[model samples]
Target chain A: MEKQQTDKRAAIMQAAMELIAEQGFHGTPTSQIAQRAGIGVGTIYRYFKDKDALIEVIHENVHGTFISTFTESYDPQLPVRENYLRIFSTLTRLFIANPYEIKFIEQFYNSPYGIAKKRADEIECDKPLFAFFGQGIQQQVVKDLPFEILLGLSLGPVLFLVRDHQNGFVNLNDQLIADIVSASWDAVKR
Target chain B: MEKQQTDKRAAIMQAAMELIAEQGFHGTPTSQIAQRAGIGVGTIYRYFKDKDALIEVIHENVHGTFISTFTESYDPQLPVRENYLRIFSTLTRLFIANPYEIKFIEQFYNSPYGIAKKRADEIECDKPLFAFFGQGIQQQVVKDLPFEILLGLSLGPVLFLVRDHQNGFVNLNDQLIADIVSASWDAVKR
Candidate 1:
C-alpha cells in the first residue's frame, strides 16, 4: 500500500512537471495534472493540500533529482580534471534528457516560487558543489581562489552553451560539446 | 536644439530603465515613465512612437554604449591576457555603474524583444566580439578552440558575478572582481 501511494505521488509530480513546462507554472491547471496522471482530482488533493503545495513538491523533486544525479556520480578519488569532466558530461546529458526540467528550473529561479526555496537549498545541496571545487584547490589541481570564483570560471561556459541551446540560437553536437569541455578544462586545470 | 532633444531622449530612456527595473516591463506604464522623466506624455510620443518604440531605443542605446565603451578601450594590438583584463575591467565598471541595465537586458532577452533585434545585432555588432577573440587565437595568445567556446570561457565568470550582484547574493568588490578576472585568464590563456 505504501509503495502504491508513492507511485501515485510520483505520477502526479511527473504530470505536473510536463504541464508546467508546456504552459508555464501560471498557465497550468491542477485539473490538467490530475487528468494527465490518470488519477482523479481528489487524489491530487490527497497528495498535495493545494496547488501551491503541488508546485513546491515539484520544485523540490526536480532539485533533489538534480542533486542526487550530480553527487551520485561524483567520485572524490578521481583526478580533479576527470571529476570535472564527469560533472560536465553528466549535466549536459541530464539537461538534454530533461529539457523540461531545465526550462522549469530556469523559469523557477527567475520567479517567486524559487525565492522561497533557494536559501534552504543553497544551504543544503548547492554549497557542496562549491565545496567540491574547494577540495580541488586544496589538492592543488585547481587554481587557488575563492571557490565561488572558481565555480563561475568552470561552469560559466556551460551555462552559455545551455542557454544558447534552449533559445535555439545554436545547434550543439558532440564535437561542439567536446570542444567546450576541452576549452573549459584548459581554462580551469592547473 | 538638436542637443537639447538628445538630452531629453537620454533622460527618458534612463527613467524607463529605472521603472522597468523596479516594476518589471509588464507592470510599468508609459505615464509613469513620463512622470519620472518630468516630461509631458506628448514629449515621450515625440521621441518614441509608442511604448515598444521606446524600449527599442533603450535597447539600442544600452547595446551601443556597451559595445562602444568596450571597443574604444580595447587595443587589438595588446597581448591576449592584457586585452582580456582590460575588456573585463571595463565591462565590470559598466555593469556596476548601470546595474539596472543588466536586469533590463535579461528580461528583454527572455521576451519577444530579443528575437526581434538579435538577428540584426548578430550581423552588425555581435560578430565583432567573436572576431576579436578569433584575432586572439590567431595571435596564439588564446587557446585554439571554436571562438564562441573561447568567448564563453572568457566571459562566463563576469556574467555570473553580475548575476550574483544583482540578486544580492554577493557583494561586488575590487578584490573579488580581480581574482575572478585573473582566474578566468588563467583558464583560457595558452
Candidate 2:
C-alpha cells in the first residue's frame, strides 16, 4: 500500500512537470494534471494541498537534485576554473538527461513562483557555488565583476546550449561540452 | 479622431505587454487587459481579433524594432568582432531602456506561442545577424561550432545579465557592457 501511494505521487509529479514545462503555469490546471497522470482529482489533492503547493514541491525536488549535482565532489581548494568545469560538465549532463525537469526549472525560475521562492530561500540554495565564485574573485583568478554578472557569464551559455540541445538544434557531445566549458572559463578568468 | 485611435492602440499594446510580461499568457484575460488599458474589452476586438491576435501584433511590433536596432549601421565587410560589439552595445542599450518589451520577448520566446511562431517564420527574422555569424565561421574568425551554439555563447550571457539587471541585482554601466561584450567575443572567437 505504501509503495502504491509512492508510485501515485510520482505519477502526479511526472505529469505535472511535463505539462507545466510544455505549457506555462497559468495554462495548466490541477484537473488537467490529474487527467494526464491517469489519476483522480481527489488523489492529487491527497498528495498536495493545492496547485501552488504541488508546484512548489516539484521545484524543491528538481532544484535539490540540480544543486547536488553542481556541488558533487566540489573542492574550494581546487582551481576555480577546474571547479567550474567540473560543475559545468555534471550539470550539463544532468540537464541533458532530464529535459522535462530542466525545462520546468527554466520556466519556473523565470516565473513569479520561482522568483518568490528564490527571495524566501534567499541564496541559501547554492551557498557553496556562490562562495566558490567569490573565492575566485578574491584570489584574482576570476574577473572582478559583480557576482550576478559572473554567474551569467559562467552558466548562461550552458543553459542556452542545453535549450538548443533539447530543441534538437544542437547535439551536446562530450567534446562539445568540454569546449563550451573552456569557453565559459575564458569568459570569467582574469 | 485618428490621433485618439492611435493613442488607444498604443495604450492597449502597453497594457497588454506589461500584463503578459508579469503574468503568463493564459493567466491574463482580455477583460483584464481592457481594464488595465482603461478601455472596453470591445475596443480590443476593434483593434485585434482576439487575445492571441493581440499578442501576435505586439510581438511583431516589438521584434521588428529590436531587429532594426541589431541591423542598424551593420556592415558585413567589418571585422566580426567590431560588428558584434556594435550590435551588442545597441541591443543592450535598447533592452535596458525598455525592460517590459524585452521581458515580453524573453517570455514569449520560451513559450509555446513563441515556438510555433518561430517554426512558422523559420529563421527569416534575423537573416543579417545569422549571415554575419556564418561569414565569421567561413573566415575562420569564429569557432567552428554549430550556429545555435555560437548564438548561445555570444548572446546568452547578455540575456542572462539583462534579467539580473531587471531584478535589481546588477547595474550594467557602459564600461561593464563593453567588458562583457569583449568576453562574449572571447567565447566565440577562434
Candidate 3:
C-alpha cells in the first residue's frame, strides 16, 4: 500500500476498534465505521474484502500488540522474578492504559468470532509468556508445574482482577496490585 | 405447584439448557425449546414472563446446583485447607461433568446478561465459598487478602483450566488438578 493508503487504513482500523469496542462486532455497521474513519464506504472495500476480514485483521492486530508489548519488556538476562514481573506489570499497565485494547480482547474472547479464531489458528498466541514461565520452571525458580498450570495460577487472577476493576466490582490500587503480585509470585515460587 | 407442574417446569429447564448450550442465547428460540421439551409453545409463556426470565432461571439453576453440590460436601469444622480443597475439586468436577452447564456459563459470562446479572445480584451467590474464605482470613489461616482476590486466584485458575480443557487446548489430569490446588493454597496461605 502507498503512504496515503497506509495512513487511511490505519485510520479505519482505529475507527473500527473504537466502534467495535463500544458496540461490539454484531452491533457495528461498516458504513458507520467508514464515516468514523473519514473515508468512503468503497475505500474500506479497497483495504479489506469484508467485515469478517476486517475483524480478522483487527483481532490479529490486537493480539500482536499485546505480544509486542510483552516481548519488548522481557529481558532474559535479568533475574527470573524481575523478568516475569516486567511481563506482568507491563501488560497490566498497558491493558489499563488502553481500555480499547482490553475491551476489544474481552469482547473477542467472548464472541463466536473469537472462539472460531482460536480453533482455526494452530499457532499458540502469548508464546512469550509461555517462554518466560518455561524458563522459570527449568531454572527451578518457579514451581515445577506445567506451563499451562502456572499460567492459570498467575495470569488467570490478573485477568479476572482487571475484569473486576473494569466492571466496578473492585477498586484497584497500588497496594492491591502489590498484594496480588505477592500472592501470584508465591503461587509459583519454588 | 402440583407435582405434574413441577415435572413440566423441570422438563422446560432441561430442554432450554440443552438448546442454549448448543446454540447460545440468540440462536435458540423459545418455540424450539418448547418443541424440544414436548410441550406447547404457550406453556413456555405460562412458565416464564419472557426469554430473559427463562435465562435468568437457568442461571440461577446452574449456580444453585453448583452451590448445593459444594455445600453438601462441605463441613465447616474441617480444616481450612480441606474446606477449600473440597470447593476447588467439587466445582471443577461439576463443571467438567456438565459440559452443557459450562457452555451455558461461558456464553452467559461473555454476554451483557452475565455482566448485568453480576451487578444486580447480591452477595448471596457464592455464600459458601465466601464463608470459607472469610473464616480462613479471620483465623489467619489464609493470607489477610480480600475474599474476592483469593477467589480470583483460586477459582479463576479452575475456571480457565476447565475452559481450556473443554477447548482441547490442555488435558485435565489428576496431577494437574493437584498442582493447581497446591499453587492456589500457596497463593492464599499465610
Candidate 4:
C-alpha cells in the first residue's frame, strides 16, 4: 500500500511539473494536474497541501537531480581538468534532458521565491558541485578567484549558448559545445 | 533655437529615464516625467508622440552613451590584451557610475519593448563592438571560436561581478575587478 501511494505521489509531481512548465505556476490549476496524472484531485491534496507545496517539491526535486547527477559521475581522484570536463558535460546533458527544470530554476532564482529558503539548506543542496570546484582550487588547477566567480566564468558561457539556442539566435552543435567547454576551461584553469 | 531645442529634448529624455528606472514602464506616467523635468506635459508630447516613443528615445540615448564610451576608448591598434583591458576598464567605470542604466538596460532587454526592434537595428547598434572582437579573432589574438561564444566567454564573468555587487554578495574593489578581468581574459584570449 505504501509503495502504491508513493508511486501515485510521484506521478502527481511529474504531472504538476509538466503543467507548470506549460502554463507557469499561476496559470496551472490543481484539477488540471490531477486530470493529467490520471489521479483524483484528493490524492494530489494528500501528497501536497497546496500549490505552493507542490512547487516547492518540484524545485527540490530538480535541485536534487542536478546534485545527484554531478556527484554520481564526479571522480575526486581524477585530474582537475578531466573532473571539470565531466561535471560540465554531465550538467549539459542533464539540462538538455530537462530544459523545463532549467527554466523553472532560473525563473525561481530571479523571483522573490528564492529568498525564503534557509541559506544553509541551499548550500547543503549544492555542496557536491561546490566541493568539486573547491577541489580544483585546492589543487591549483583553477584560479584563486572566489568560487562563485569561478563558477560564473565556467558556466555563464554555456548558459548564454543555451539562451541563444532558445532564442533561435544560434544553433547548438557539438562543435559549438566543444568550443565553449574548451574556451571556458582555458579561461579558468591555472 | 536649435541648441535650446536640443537641451529641452535631453532634459525630457533624462527625466523619462529617471522615472522609468524608479517605477518601471507600466508604473510611470507622463505627467510625472514632465513634473520631474520642470516642463509642461504638452512639451513632452511635442517631442514624444507617446510613452512608447519616449521609451524609444531613452533606449537610443542609452545605447548611444554605451557605444560612444566603448568605441571612443577602444584602440583597435593595440594588442588584443591591452585593447581588451582598456575596454573592460572603461565599461566597468561606466557601469559603476550608472548602475541604474545597466539595470534598466537589462530589464528592457527582457521586455516586450526591446523585442519589438528588428534584428538589423539591434545588430547595427552593436556593430562597432562586434567589429572590434572580430578583428581580434582575425588577428589570431583571441580564440578562434564562434563570435557569440567568444563574447560570452569574455563578458560572462563581468556580468556575474555586476550581479554580485548589486545583490551585495561581494564587494567591487579594484583588486577584485582586476582579478576577474584577468581570469576572464585568460579563458578566451589565445
Candidate 5:
C-alpha cells in the first residue's frame, strides 16, 4: 500500500511536469494534470494541497536531483578547474537526458511564480556550486566578477546550446560537449 | 482619424505585451488586455485577427526593432571582432532598455509557439549576423564551430546576464556589459 501510494505520487508529478513544461503554467489546469496522470483529480489533491503546492514540490524535486547529480562525486580538494568541469559536464548530461525537466525549469524561472519565489528568497542559491566559484575567484583562477555574472557566463551558453539541441538544431555529441565546456571555461577564467 | 486608429492599435499591442510578459499566454485574457488598454475588447479584434495573431505581430515588431538597432551603424568593413562587439553591445543595451520586451522574448522562445515557429523554420535566422559569423570563421578569426553553437556562445551569457539584471541579482552597467561581451567574444574567437 505504501509503495502504491508512492507510485501514484510519482505519477502525478510526472504528469504535471510534462504538461507544465509543454504549456505555460497558466495554460495547464489541475484537471488536465489528473487526466494525463490517469488518476482522479481528487487523488492529486490527496498528494498535494493545491496546484501551487504541487508545482513547488515538483520544483524542489527536480532541482534537488540536479544538485545531487553534479555534486555526487565532487571533491573540494580537486583543482577548481577540474571541479568546475565535473559539475558542468555532469549537469549538461543530466539536462540532455531529461528534456522535459529542462523545459519545465526554463518555464518556471521565467514565470511570475518563479519571480515571486525568487523575490521571497524561497529559491535558495545552489551553495555548493557558488562555493566552488568563490574559491576559484579567491584563488585567482577565474574572473573577478559577481557570482551572478559568473553563473550566467558559465551556464548561459550551455542552456542555449541545450535548447538548440532539443530543437534539433544541433546534436551535442561527446566531442562537442567537451569542446563547448572548454570554451565556457575560457569565458570565465581570468 | 487615421492617427487615432494608429494610437488605438498601439495601445492594444502595448497592453497585450505587458500582460503576456507578466503572465503566461494562457493566463492572460484578451478582455483583460482590453481593460488595461482602456479600450473595448472588440477594439483588439478589429486591429488583430486574434490573440495568436497579436502575439505574432508583437514578435515581429520586437525582433525587427532589435535587428534594426544592431544593424543600423553596422559596418561590415570593420574587423569581425569590432563588428561583433558593436552588435553585442547594441543588442544588450536594447534588452536593458526594454525589460518587458525581453521577458516577452524569453517566454516566447521557450514556449510552444516559439518551438513550433522554429521547427517550421518560420523564425528566420538573422542573415546579417549569420554572415558576420560565417565571415569570421572563413577568415579563421573565430572558432570553426557550427553557427548555432557560435550563436549560443555569443548570446547565451548576454541573455542570462540580462535576466539576472532584471531580477536585481546583478547591476549590468556599461563596464560590465563591455567585459561580458568581451568574454563572449573570447568564447567564440580563435
Candidate 6:
C-alpha cells in the first residue's frame, strides 16, 4: 500500500514537471495537470495541498535529483583541479541530458516564488558544490574573492553556455566544452 | 504631435517592460499593461499590433540599448587589454544600473517567443561586441579558439555575475569586479 502511494505521488509529480516545463506555471492549470496525470483533480490535493505546494515539491525533486545523481561519485579527497572538472562536467552532462529541467529551473529561479526563497537561502546555502570552492580556496588553488564572486566567475560560464545551447543559441561541441572548462578554471583558479 | 506619439509609445513600452519583468509573459495580460501605462487599452493597439509585437520591440530596444550605450566609447585603436577591460566594465555597469531590464531580458530569452526569434538570429547575431573578440584573436592577444567559444568563456562570467548581484545572491564590489575582469581576460588572453 505504501509503495503504491509513493508511485502515485511520483506519477503526479512527473505530470506536473512535464506540464510546468512545457507551458510554465501560469500557462499550466491545475485541471490540466490532473488530466495529464490521469488522476482526478481531488487526488492532487491528497498528495499536495495546492498548486503552489506541488510546485515546491517539483523544485525539491529537481534539485534533489541533481545533487544526489551528480555527486554520487564525488570524492572530496581528490585534488582541487580534478574535483573542479568533475563538478563542471557533471553539471554540463546533467543539463545536456535534461534540457527540460533547465527550462523549469530558469522559470523557478526568475519567478517571485523562486526569488524569495533564493534570496533567503543563497547567502547561507553552502551545499557540497559550494564547499568545493571553499576547499579550493584553502588549498590556494582558487581565488580569494568572496564566495559569490567565485561562484559567478567560475561556474557562470558553463551555466550560461548550457542555457544558450538549450535555447539553440550555440552548439555545444566537444571542443567547445573543453575550452569552457579550461576557461572557467582559469577564471577562479589562482 | 510626433513628440506626443513618441512619449506615449515610450510610456506603453516602459509599462510592458516592468510588467513582463516582474511577471512572465504568460502571467501578464495586455489589460494590465494598459492600466499600468495609464492609457486606454485601445491606445496599445495603436502602437503595437499585439502583445508579441510589443515584446519584439522590447527585445530590439534592450539589445539596441546595450550595444549602443556599452559601445559608445569603445575604440578598437586601444591596446587589447585596455579594450577588453573597457568592454567588461561597461557591460557590468550597464546591467547593474538597469536591473529591471536584465530581469526582463532573462524572461524574454527563456520564453518560447524569445527562443524562436533568438535561435533564428543567433547564428548571424555577431555584432560590434563580438568584433572585439575577433580583434583580440587577430592580434594574438586572445585565444585562437572559435569565436563563439571565446564569447562563452569570456563574457559569460560577467553576464552571470551581474545577474547574481541583481538577484541578491551576490554583492558586487570594486575588488570583486576587478578580479572578475582579470579572470575573464585570462580565460581568453593568450
Best by DockQ: 5
Model 2, residue B50: C-alpha shift (Å): 0.8
Choose 3 or 5, whichever is better by lDDT. 5
Which digits, one per residue and each the tens of the lDDT, describe model 4 over residues B75-145? 86888788888777677768767866776565455444464463554577457768877888888888877
Better of 2 and 5 by lDDT: 5
Model 4 segments more than 4 A misplaced: A1-55, A115-122, B1-61, B112-122
DockQ of each: 0.39, 0.67, 0.56, 0.33, 0.74, 0.66
lDDT tens digits, residue span A17-38, model 3: 9888876776678999999999
Residue B29 shift from truth in candidate 6, angstroms: 3.7
lDDT (10s digit) by residue, model 1, range A99-165: 7787777656655457656667755765657767887878888777665566667677787767667
Best by lDDT: 5
Q: Which residue pairs overlap in candidate 5's backbone?
A: none
Give the B-chain TM-score of model 2: 0.91
DockQ of 3: 0.56
List model 1 lDDT by residue over B91-153, tens digit each. Answer: 887887788887777656545446567657645755656777787778888777766566677
Candidate 3 residue spans exceeding 4 A from truth: A1-12, A29-46, A119-123, B1-12, B29-47
Error (Å) of candidate 3 at residue A187 is 1.4
Q: Candidates 2 and 6: which is better by lDDT?
A: 2
Model 2, span B1-190: residue lDDT tens: 9999999999999999998888767667889999999999899989889888889999999988887777775888788889989887777788999899988987788787698676444376457767988999998998888777778887789888888788776899999998888888888888
Candidate 3 local Cα displacement, residue A98, angstroms: 2.2
Say what the interface RMSD of candidate 4 is: 3.4
Of the pair 4 and 5, which is ahead by DockQ? 5
Give the 10-residue window scoring lowest on summed lDDT in candidate 3 chain B. Answer: B118-127
lDDT of 6 by residue, A1-190 (tens): 9998898898888888887777777878889988988888899999999889999988877877776776674779999998877777777878878877777877787777788776654544456657878888998999888887777776778887887787666788766777788777877889
TM-score of each: 0.80, 0.94, 0.86, 0.75, 0.94, 0.89
* TM-score of predicted chain B versus true chain B for each candidate: 0.86, 0.91, 0.83, 0.83, 0.92, 0.89
Model 1 Cα shift for residue A105 (angstroms): 1.5
